[model samples]
Target: MESSSPPADTNRASTAEGLRFAFGTLTVLPVRVARWDRAAARTGMVCAPLVGLVVGLVAAAVGAVLLWCGASPLLAAVAAVAVPAVLTRGLHLDGLADVADGLGSGRPAEEALRVMKQSDIGPFGVITLVFTLLGQVAAVAALYGQGWAWGAVGAVASAVVARGALTLASREGVPAARPEGLGAAVAETVPFGAALGVAGCCVAVPAAGSAAVAGSAGQVVGAAAGAVLGLCAAEVLLRRCVRRFGGVTGDVFGAVAEVAACGTLVVLAVL
Candidate 1:
């Protein structure tokens, strides 16, 4: 029998076409970067809050189920942590470690990026990740134990607000450290409005609910405090990244998201 012949270029073209068709649904670009075009950016900005909404729903559902199942608050908290890790495939955590390593090394920006790109984790990265996760776990467990729904809300809100930070940072003339990547795409798309919308939805919705829970104005005040803290943290990180790297990278964006999330959680827990 004759040997089978390989597929022709037409087959390759068809495969490429299929991939292109699937790209729209497979990517999370719209969340991190709004569109540079006015209309597209607006649409993306409007949809930006939806990411938080989804994360919030997921956290709430899981928390409810765990509570109902009589799991301890600690276990429930662990579940909350697991949700995002699973959803994003630990991308933010990896970014956190890499960014910590880069920042701690006192190396030049290029060298920092090179170190982050390496697979090995440095001492700074390891210590930061450990403490960060411990803090998150403790905060979640404590809030849940106190029967406060604000923890779940904060988790979701952080997702949106963090993206908002990333979007806003992109607009402030931060070049993409790499020639092409998610950072560049985000820089091209993220507009101011999307960032604003995200901040509004995250802070406002939670504030309203918190006010009802407290039966006083303190809830709103607390929520505002949390929002401000998160925003400030993001801005500080953005400025530092810009000064150090001359532009933001995907890793830095990830770092911002992680920091904002942690900062929001800390503020909520304290207040």
Candidate 2:
């Protein structure tokens, strides 16, 4: 977002650092992050969707291979849904559960944050995890039932949108709830315009590709609409987190990603 032209070498180095930061922080990948400052975080947040693309492709590949092996749609869907979780080491899912418990605790902000930091999941957390996982699996299964391509497109689109939501969440003015940890390290690193531009590009490519594959105008419209609605859902949760928890945390980021991904899958399945 900084418009001042820097040296080409510096630009290349920064981009490499950012990519390493994005992959290292967001996934269980072996990439080592060489920098943790705002400059790297800014680029990393912009590159978050790229990480999602890889994750989605892996998930799609697993499902496609399972289907080719004569596995049932339900089983393939389960594998697809499980792939991202495994790749991320279940961090996003755990965050989703923690956020659910925090929000549902009926405690004050400080107390709720403490509740979320506990080692064990509360009842609300357990319930939220169960429903979210079930919803994702069922929706993917429905798409797989339609056809392998449809399911693959849905999986990839949902993942890309999910990570794109993280980019949006990192935009300027979104404060970190605490002074330390991941949320603090990356919060407000991305510029608002940059975030939107990245999100628009990420959403458009998949939507257009889905349409091209399906050979239907409706598919493009549906995919775009689904992405928009999913982002809106995540934004609502983000606002709530800011209001209730004081601002965003690492858990909030994870919760936002999973919610956006699940919402996108549901919309894709229906439309």
Index of the highest-lDDT prediction: 2
Best by TM-score: 2
* lDDT tens digits, residue span 24-51, model 2: 9999999999987778888998999999
TM-score of each candidate structure, all chains considered together: 0.80, 0.94
What is the C-alpha local distance difference test score of candidate 1?
0.63
The C-alpha stretches of model 2 lying farther than 4 A from their native spots are 1-13
Instruction: List per-candidate RMSD values in Å.
Output: 9.9, 4.6
For each candidate, what is the lDDT? Answer: 0.63, 0.87
RMSD of 2: 4.6
